[model samples]
Target: MISIRSVGKTYRSRHGEVVDALDDVSLDVREKEFVSIVGPSGCGKSTLLKIIAGLVPASGGEVTIRGRPVREPFPDVGFVFQNAVLLPWRTVLDNVMFSIEMLGLPGNDYRARARDLIELAGLAGFERKYPWELSGGMQQRVALCRALVHDPSVLLMDEPFGALDAMTREEMGLELLRIWEERPKTIFFVTHSIPEAILLADRVVVMTPRPGRLARVLDIALDRPRAVEMEFDPRFKAYSEEIRALIFRPRRERVH
Candidate 1:
């Protein structure tokens, strides 16, 4: 389980001005549950995910995973960023094994795991291909496999499919759902697409604009083993409209 309480982040800009990126955001995620955060650009969706991953520090409050406070990178979680960020020098198989090598784990023990993950990601034959040799979607699949090679209990994905084309993005989403169903990790996915979020997450977290705060957390009622066809469902459309309204709602006036 993951617990976030009153989390906030304030940073000083280059010009020496303070910027409030996130504020008063709190949430609880059950084991193996999938949650997605959505907000306007610059609302600190990425920041919040980083905080949960212990990649970034929170300015206030605390985030705890399974009763442990998060301060720095932990071993039980994996992060997939917007970019695949694969090394030009590494092949798909080698890239997937990179995590194991970096962690100083025995290569012999994890090579099988790496190959299994590569196969799971449908990159079996491309294991020897370099990042440039693969298309964008395949690269992201390699990145995802790399993140999961160590078998993390929690997965933090910051719009991993954001850079793909629409069709590729949906394909990747379906791939992610397949991976999650098979592995069942606690996942925190951050995305701009409401339909994608709804399709992938058990709960959708909506945020206010700047000085981001939790606007709402909607429990998606759509059935599990989700499909693109569900997007046409009335319930799916209703959830989309509700989240859209929350996101596009007028900002409350601030009285100085």
Candidate 2:
């Protein structure tokens, strides 16, 4: 489980102006729970994830995972960025094993796990292929495998599918759900797409613009193994409309 208490982040510009990225943000993600954060650009969604992952220090407040405060890069957390960020020179298998190498973990110990993850992502035969040979979606799948190779307890994903084509993005979403079902990890996914957030999360955490604050957290009551066709459900529409309204409404009128 994770807890973020009164967390805030500020940045100093080259001109010495102070910009607040996150303000008084507090949230909790239960064990093995999937939470999606959606907000406007510069709203600190990614910043919050970085804080949780301990990739960056919070300017104020604290983030703790399983009761321990996070102060530095968490060894038990995995990260997937907007880009695949694969080493082009490495083969698919090597890329997945890259994390193991960085962690100074024994390569032989994780080889089977890496191969299984590659297959789970539906890239079985392509393990020997290079990044340049794979499609955008396939490349991201490799990145996902790499993130999971170490079997981290929590996965911090920042728009892992944002760059793919629409069709591919949808496909990857389904793929991600399937993988999560088989190998569930506490996942905090940050995305800009409303529908994508709803489709993938058990709860959607809405955030405000710069000086980002938690606006609302809506529980998704949709059934499991949700398909794209389910987007037509009236409940889905209602959730989408509510979230859109929250994002577009003036801050003063917003209800948290």
Candidate 3:
């Protein structure tokens, strides 16, 4: 579980002015729950993810994973970026084994696990292929396998499928659901697509622009073990629309 309380981040510009990225963002993510954060660009969605992952520090407030304060990147959490970030020289298997190596495990120990993950990700026949040799979707699959190879308890994904084409994005979404079924983990996904968030997450968190704050938390009560067919369901569309309204609702002026 991850808990963020009164978290705020501010940076000083070259001119000595402060820029606020996040403000008083508070939320709790339960174990085995898949949550996605959506907002306008520069809403600090990525910053919030990084803060939880310990990749960045909050200027104020607290972030904790499983009740312990998050000061540094924990081994139990895996991060996937928009780019695969795979090494050009590393083959698929070697890439997936990178985390195992980082954990100081013997090569022979994690070789089978890496192989199984690669195969499970639908890259069994491409284990020997380098990142450059595969399509964009295949490369993202490699990144996903690499993130999950170590069996992390939490997965932090920042638009992992945003770079793919429309068709490939849909395919990857279905594939991700299948993967989630096989191995349930606490997942925090950051994306701009309402449908994508509605389709994948148990809860969707909407945020405002800069100095990002939580606008709303929406529970997707569609169904469990969501399949691709769920996307066409009316409930899914209703959820999407509900979030859309929350995101763009008209504001009223305050009277003095």
Query: In model 2, which regions exceed 4 Å deviation?
Result: none
lDDT of each: 0.93, 0.94, 0.89
Which 10 consecutive positions of candidate 1 have the poorest summed lDDT?
A: 247-256
Model 2 lDDT per residue over 65-129, tens place: 99999999887999999999999899999999999999999999999999999999999999999
Q: Go through the candidates in order and give the C-alpha RMSD of each one to the true structure.
A: 1.8, 1.0, 2.0
In angstroms, the error of model 3 at 223 is 1.4
**Candidate 2 clashing pairs, residues 3+ apart or interchain:** none
lDDT of 3 by residue, 1-256 (tens): 7899999999888999988999999999999999999988888999999999999999999999999999999999999998888999999889898888887778897788889888888898899999999999999999999899888999999999999998898789878878888999999999888988988899999987678898889999988767778989999988888778766765342111
Against the hidden reference, what TM-scores do the models get? 0.97, 0.98, 0.95
lDDT of 1: 0.93
Which scores higher on TM-score, 1 or 2? 2
Instruction: Give one digit per residue, the lDDT tens place, for model 1 in 63-111.
Output: 9999999999898899999999999998899998898888888999999
Evaluation by lDDT, superior candidate among 1 and 2: 2
**Candidate number achieving the greatest lDDT relative to the actual structure:** 2
Cα lDDT over the full model 3: 0.89
Task: Please give the lDDT score at residue 254 for candidate 3.
Answer: 13
